[model samples]
Target: MGIELAWTHGVYVLFVLGIILMMVLRRDTSLISIIGIAFLGLTATGSVIASVGGIFGSFIYAITELLPTILVICIIVAMSHVLTDTGVNETMIRPMTHLIRNATLAYWVIGIVMMVISWFFWPSPAVALIGAVMLPVAIRAGLPAIGVAVSMNLFGHGIALSGDYVIQGAPSLTAKAAGIPVNDVIAASIPLVIVMGVVTTVVAFWYLRKDMKNGMIAPASHNPVTSSVFSSAKVPLAPGIKRTLAALVPILFVLDVVAMFVFDLRGGEATALVGGTALLILIAATMLAHKQKGLEQVTTHLIQGFQFGFKVFGPVIPIAAFFYMGDSGFNTVLGEVLPQGSHGIVNDLGVALAHTIPLSKEVAALTLTAVGVITGLDGSGFSGITLAGSLAQLFATALGSGVATLTALGQIAAIWVGGGTLVPWALIPAAAICGVDPFELARRNLYPVVIGLLVTTIFAMFLL
Candidate 1:
């Protein structure tokens, strides 16, 4: 039986589609998202006053949820500014320039590094670490900044995050929900993740190279946070001092990695570790480089970093607010509006979708992918994965096979779509760091991810 639908669900889905339509047209979605939130509030509460307050409340919820990311980005950007100002950034990347001398090498090398690091610490930290260091090198090696963003996003968030082989967080969630062993989900996902990662990245790279050669891509502008905020007065660090700081930076980060492994830190703990380290580095670098003015310079760099962080995230907040309502933000924003027994708006929709589909290996594969995609629209790749696993179990019972394969397929699709690559707000870290429009990154990823999902789903059918 299908879950009962509420008016809130219909309204939510309508606005989601509208937001997507606006995005597809390359239009700003903030207005649409805000309007949607207001309407959802009004429809649920029947009061203009409450509805208006809900809009602001939803933004709070979004910001609260996104604060860690914002903090990390702001700190990392500040640290990066200091590194650049002190000439330490150039010294740091000088050795890497030899390894990534061309655009092709830059793309793959950075992507591979991102994927590996993400497997250990998750994509959020990996993005900060790699973007801070590799972005300049990649841009200098002739890869556009957006291209660098795409490579890191696809490899880290898309590939390593989806598989989550080392941490096993993604698989553990799906496995528990599917009533199967975590190893089964992991084992099943290895092939699907490989196929999706290889196909999507190859296609994206091909398109990127073709566009570059055709002169269709523009050279990237410098990050406004760094360029505009950095004073014309360069910090006169001795070459030896700059080299020492540069060397120290990597050693500090490497120790953080060792700590992650020893302490079993993951996700927010991992991000906090990285952010705290960046803060110390920012302070140290500023003090070392600025001498007499160091105290004041650190504050200036931090303010600049916060400005850029919020500026880049401004358009994203409203949309994220709207989507967050589809999950945990519902009660927080609108208060007991959804029908009783509802599994959140998005999950209910996924459940309804699964019930409506007929059972066959091909249909089951396709339905799981669709459910995964639908649930992923909430932008928390994880929020609806349990539903995906449950749906996978349901379909597998009906088809008498392929539970692990279907579960893996759903997990992969969910993470690829919402974990980052195709979601504008979800991918902000990469986009903001690389100084590209998040929507454009999402658009660029759309075809490749869609094609990959199609191919991987078909492959899942065969595995069944």
Candidate 2:
């Protein structure tokens, strides 16, 4: 049987094209494009009443599906805020100063710390904690602001956020679209994340070396925070009890890894362990800061944490809602009213294209990866994952590749681009926080992240 493209599908295609054009020419948010497309889809498919129903339905569905993930994010971020306000974040980084006496060491240390913390709590919270404290130290150690930003982007956003092992946010989204276990996604993602991280980090280091040699960059000299706040505290003992805690943190995490291997705890179990640890740390930090004021301080930190979480994820909801409409499983919630046995809009499109294009397993993987990178040009990393995940399911069945592998590949590519590498606007926050030019940061990231992604994609094709 031959399939005909519906007017709704045409509206979706045009809406996507318009978004791409806007991204290329104007660098505007894709939200406007999504809204336009969604309304068009509803109008094309049904009467005015149905269209209205679809809008409300989509809102409810989007909120319901996203609430769990968003709440976890908010709580974790809130916990991070509590830790930071209590000076635990500072205490955590202070010992690492000894490990970072110079620019070269500072780059790696900051990158490593950001990656580890981000893996658990996430990049948004990790950035604030790392940038506020270690940035100045890194600058004084002769690392340029741009260097710090690059390190954070590569490790925190690019690597940790892409993997998302702890909270399982990224994997959950991909897994849902692929119709697989979230644990499977996380397990399969490990090798890919390591490959991309190693490749990208090495490239970033080379760039830093070149810039240093050319005298194009130098350490930052002035810091408002240092002169005003942190300078008053007595330098804590190095490699002391605090250092033991720092060292113990990773050791505990490694033990968790071993337990994961031995006991077979999946991503959620692992996240619970990590979140529990964070809460404990928050409690300890609060007590250490002030016994009587601990309650008030923790509350304050939680508030700041929620504020930051909302800031990061607020814009993502509407965008995710529109894309969720493309998935049949989610469409019911989004107010989609399709005939029985009909495939989703995105799935049907992929199927139609696959029939005409003659895709192999390898080609499907590469194509999805490329699509991910293309969608990422809009600079909201999470937005592209749903589409890529939907495509992964279609291509996986069509070409006989595993859905998890394809989904992971797409997730990595999309995040590396939209999260901060290719898109200048997305990197602006990190750039501005580090006091560097956003365009320059984006330019510096392009070669490394692109090369890394290409290599990782090829590796995924062969290995997976």
Candidate 3:
């Protein structure tokens, strides 16, 4: 792995650290990220005009990449608004409310359900399926919106996605890259995944309980846009109608899950299916609740959803634009600026870090973890796993042992960070669905995830 660092790489690293520092300080990094893009453009192209254009180009690239996620969120939120307005949300969650009597039960039940569904259908669609029905119940049971978001995020995105046992997506990628059988990676990952999942979830719950006791966090509240939409006057559906719609919504989602299995749809396709169903639900609920004004009312709900979606995503876009440069976005936004044979800025950094480290079981395990975390900084968890897999192979070759363990370690770290519970943009689905700030969700996840990674890495060293 010979990577020639360019001036642009240094600039990118500087800005990445700056953004991270800002996040650590709880300050917004939008301006810093925008400026970083400008600097990168200027360094790569050496033209004021092109650099200015690159900033916009980067934004466009970020939006294009994020548009699918944004659209699904908007549609789901719109559907939720109509359900709330028509009183269907209450009826839908009434059954679950009996099961989850308090915050502790709410967190674990939501999390465990999220993990199971995500294992089958993948997290993106599972989030919509579970979050829509569960959030109200969790909140009603005294869990904060942030707590609900964190549970969905850590369980669905971090644990289920990292192992990806049922779908085999994550293990396939890592195993192929490591030149091992997929089963080897999966077998090796089972213990690590359990360790990470158990530790992280437990730590998070402990902190949550402590905070709730001290009154550090509030009970769930609606986001501004949703609050306004909920406040809007609409004709209430009859109790029977609400009960019928409530039953119908879950049946529709369950069918979507079944379709996923029959059709083998995953990721974007699964999300699209859920989003389309949400739109249909939105239209049906609007027509039933506001017969004469249904057309206008549905449009109004959509508008509010869009408003909420964009508001949540606005601060994230610039930061996302900056991180995108770590991968494919660099060349697309600013032309060929990286040195020849470079595997993008982030990948190159991971390779360089791996090369600099000495090879031993402990060093190998730790270095792979570091490489996984570094590569994950791109915020596309899967994007960097190939590099992690390759590095794992390299280290295992030198040590003559522990290839599977190292590969699994790297995969776990990468997904936990980027697939992800740490990255704000990557965790947006849970945050948006629960009506919480993505950054705060990321913050609440940081300590528990970090501690989990630390313990898991040590455990990996033992397995090695």
Candidate 4:
């Protein structure tokens, strides 16, 4: 194990610490992140002019990587606004009022429902759909707004996004990186995913329930309509249109999910199905409400949607840019020229750790988990999956451990953190929709997710 930490690797660690500090302090680190990028670029290139250019380039790179997520969110928010305008959002929630009769039931139902939807359509779009429909219902049913946020974050982002069972995108990334069949990683991931999901969500539910009993969590009169974009100009609709659109909207999304499976769609294809459906729904619903004036109002909704998207997109850009540096693929795009043998700071540190650490199955499991968590800091959970897979293979060769289980364990850790549960930037979609602070939401998720990861790592030992 020849572990030589480079100067760039040390700076990367410092920046990561800086990021965590900002999150802990509830401060925005966009400026600090940009500064970090500039400094990294300067150190790597030994050129002031190139380093300055790298700052803008890194930001652009980050935006390009996250464009799909931004677009999906913008389109969904627009669709939701149109639904609200037509009174369809309210009508949709009306039927669910009976099903979620109390706070306890509401919490579980909201989480479970988000998980199911996210499994099919991915959590980025599911956050909007679930938040629009179920959040208000859960609030009305006596769940605290923050508790509702926690439930959705843990289940949708933490569990479903981490596992990605239906889509299997996460597993495929890990599998491909590890040079193994996708099915092996997916099959290996089941127990670990289940253990992590069950443990984290259950712990969260118990904590929330206890908080409710202790009056720490508000049980009633929780404000659900907290986001500005969601509080739009709602027109009183005739019962017929409200009923018709409300019924059709969910069916359309569900059919879209079904079509994804039937046609073997995944990744961008699945995202397009969701986003395209939302856009079409936005058009039809807006036209239904405005009729002759539909042309004007539809423009209004799109403008509002883009505004909301950009608002969220701004803070996200710098954070993502800093993290994207952790992935080797972005080294050339985001920064100045690097020295020979130096690439991604995070991957380099990961390699150093793997080489330096003592060879033992137990130690390797925990080490890989830590590496996955570190790699996931960049906010795109799937980006670090390749590193996890590669490290798993590396450790297996050294320690004779099972590659599949180690890879699976690393995948869970990465996805659970980067996929959105613990990272504030990644938690934006769920946190923004639920009208909670993303950092606070990430803080809330910290304990449950960490505990779940530790337990799941231990469980993976037997399999190995």
Candidate 5:
């Protein structure tokens, strides 16, 4: 039997095209997205008032859907800020610097440390922490500043955020959209993440070395953070406390990891565990740093944390809302004026393609990965993850592949691309901290990440 098509599907297709065009033109889709939501509402409800209402509804829905991720990142960033006050954050990387006596070693040392920290702290905090503490040493060791940014981005945002083994936010978002448990997404993504990470990082190092040998690298410049770190410390604390906290932080996180394995916490639960621990640590660190003023310090940090969190997630909410409706069920929450069996906006399109395209498993796998890459073009590695996740469910069912594997594949592609490697704006924090141009940083990371995504996508096909 042939499947029937609907006008809503066409609207969805046009909205997707609009979104893609906006991304391709490197334009912000916020306005376009708002317009699309209005039009979609008009078509569904056939009422101007309903259409206007849908705009607010979509944003609220997207924010509600994404609150967990936003909160976890905010709290983690706040916790890192608290650590910085005690100069304890620097201590975390001091030993790692000893291992990086040269630039060759600096590349891997900074990258490995970044990947580890990013898993717990999220890439935002990890980049800030690593950029402040490690960039100077890496440069001194002979690594270029662009090289440092690439290492930080590829490891922290690409590898760590993609797998998200520690925090599980990425996987959680992907899993939720796919209607699967977050643990399954996390477990399934491990191999894909490993493949992408190893391949990309190795390729990056090879390029870094070649650039140095050819003298293609620019002379390194020190940013203010680097100068500040080398300048002074008011408190004359012994190395023992720093060492203890460094040791303690990892142990506590490791325990959290173990508990995740043992207790089998899903994404939200695991996030709660990590966030709660981070908050407690933040409190303790503030108390130690400010003795009497700790209370005020903690409050100040919380406010700052929320501000940053809202800032990061603000743009994302609308984008995610426009896409979330691609999931059939969300149509109801956004105001169900569409006909029966809406199957979400994106899924409807996926189903249409499935019937018309005659896609092989390989093609389907690549297509999902391509869609993920396209979504990542929006420059928020996370904004399009839900769509990728929803599409994974659609494609897997249509192609007779495993949903978890395909979902992981899409997640990997979206993150590695938009997660900071390909996006100049996303690379700014690392690049700016390293005193490198963000565009140059993106250019440097482009080849390795692209090759890595291709390889990872193909590898994912076999699993599917």
Candidate 6:
């Protein structure tokens, strides 16, 4: 060893460099990169034993910290499934179909529907329900499977879930990490989300318009009402009454939204109201399905809901863990055994860069946005957001920059990239549900998401 380098600064630089390389190369998941870094850090500290211990320690910490949140997500998804099996999902979409007579209108309508529902109940369940019902109609109306997937991914996952304005889930996480009020984060995120949404929607239309102009797309195979999934299964409600309820579903949802706004119920309260309404609809649908089978059917739906929830959230844990280590709040959860000298790698590196790098706030905002985009390559938007938020706080302090603006820029970038736009894995559910190719969806989303991120970033630099 040539006079072994200091573990403090050098280790941090190498760790960050590894993350950048992993993202640029688009290699395996971030979890793999984290493991590699952990080992490297261990070696730099001259202790293989310590590295092994740290890995296990980190794993344990992540599990404990995530359990409660994961359980909540599971319960919520389960409830949605119960609602779906009861035919409430169909009821919700039925009225919307009347307004969407053409492919162009269908795309925007579905996007809007997904966004609204997702803002309350979340995107996981919203995707399944929307895909199962509205997709076929959109397809028949002339929207391509790729188009539908893009709409759902952009609206539900990116726009709605990213801002999480109603439920405040995403904003709450970012707010907690930044030690700010959840309401403040929600209020701040609104303009940023709108800029991103408008840019993304416009770019998507531009790309889609090319396909439309070329006339290269084939119309979807049309199936008659009697041959459809709903037709095959006997619905619980009487035909006339069920149709009435189907009509009423949209009205109920609209009422929910109106009530939320009227009451000024911002976050968890809004989510609870939506969830409660969904539950009532679910019960009614179950009873209608066949009172005899309702109980068993509800159980089955819950199982499927849990399955889907785990599928979406499981891979996120380790990724979240690696980033969580960077935050002081979660540092102790990583285990108390680590030496006090083991500084947060992300903060330490950020501080080091702040001192050396000379840049205006505008430049720093852009840089932070780019960093968020780069970190998002791992394909978990929230993970990238968490990391970006932590880094933003560091950069804000060092440069005396606008913390909210930098944080919001990072929020926009991370969500645009990892929230199912550029990454194949992140787009998997929407693609699969829409019966489109995942890689193609990723490609379709590339230009629009990038342009949206750029526009929103520039807007943030000036507006905030």
TM-score of 6: 0.63
Put down candidate 6 lDDT per residue, 65-175, tens digits, no spaces.
545434444444554454344455556555556777887898899899999877866665566556645775676567777788889989988899778877676676777
Q: Return the clash pairs for model 1, or none.
A: none
The clash count for each model shown is: 0, 0, 0, 0, 6, 2
Off by over 4 Å in 1: 221-233
Model 1 lDDT-worst window of ten: 224-233
Candidate 3 per-residue lDDT, tens place, 379-398, comes to 88999998889989989998
Per-residue CA lDDT of model 5 for 208-303, tens digit only, reads: 889888978865645432333444444444578767776776567667667766886644676677777778777877777677887998998888
lDDT of 2 by residue, 158-246 (tens): 99989988768888998998988989888888999999999999998998889888977743544322222243333233335444554
Lowest summed lDDT window (length 10), candidate 2:
223-232
Model 5 local distance difference test score: 0.72
Q: Which stretches of candidate 3 lie over 4 Å from their true place?
A: 222-234
| Per-residue lDDT value at 6 in model 4 | 59
RMSD of 3: 1.6
**Candidate 4's residue-wise lDDT over 130-150, tens digit each?**
776677677768777788889
Which ten contiguous residues of candidate 4 have the minimum total lDDT? 223-232
TM-score of 2: 0.61
Segments in model 6 whose C-alpha atoms lie over 4 Å from true places = 1-94, 112-149, 152-196, 205-231, 234-237, 244-252, 262-269, 276-280, 312-333, 336-344, 360-362, 371-411, 414-447, 455-464
State the local distance difference test value for candidate 1.
Answer: 0.89
Candidate 5 has its poorest 10 consecutive residues by lDDT at 223-232
Candidate 4 residues lying further than 4 Å off, grouped into runs, are: 1-3, 173-184, 210-234, 332-336, 462-464
lDDT of each: 0.89, 0.67, 0.89, 0.78, 0.72, 0.63
Error of 1 at 63 (Å): 0.3
The TM-score-based order of candidates, best leading, equals: 3, 1, 4, 5, 6, 2
Return the TM-score for candidate 1, rounded to 2 decimals. Answer: 0.97
Q: Native-vs-model 2 lDDT?
A: 0.67
Clashing pairs in 2: none
- Ranking of candidates on lDDT, top first: 1, 3, 4, 5, 2, 6
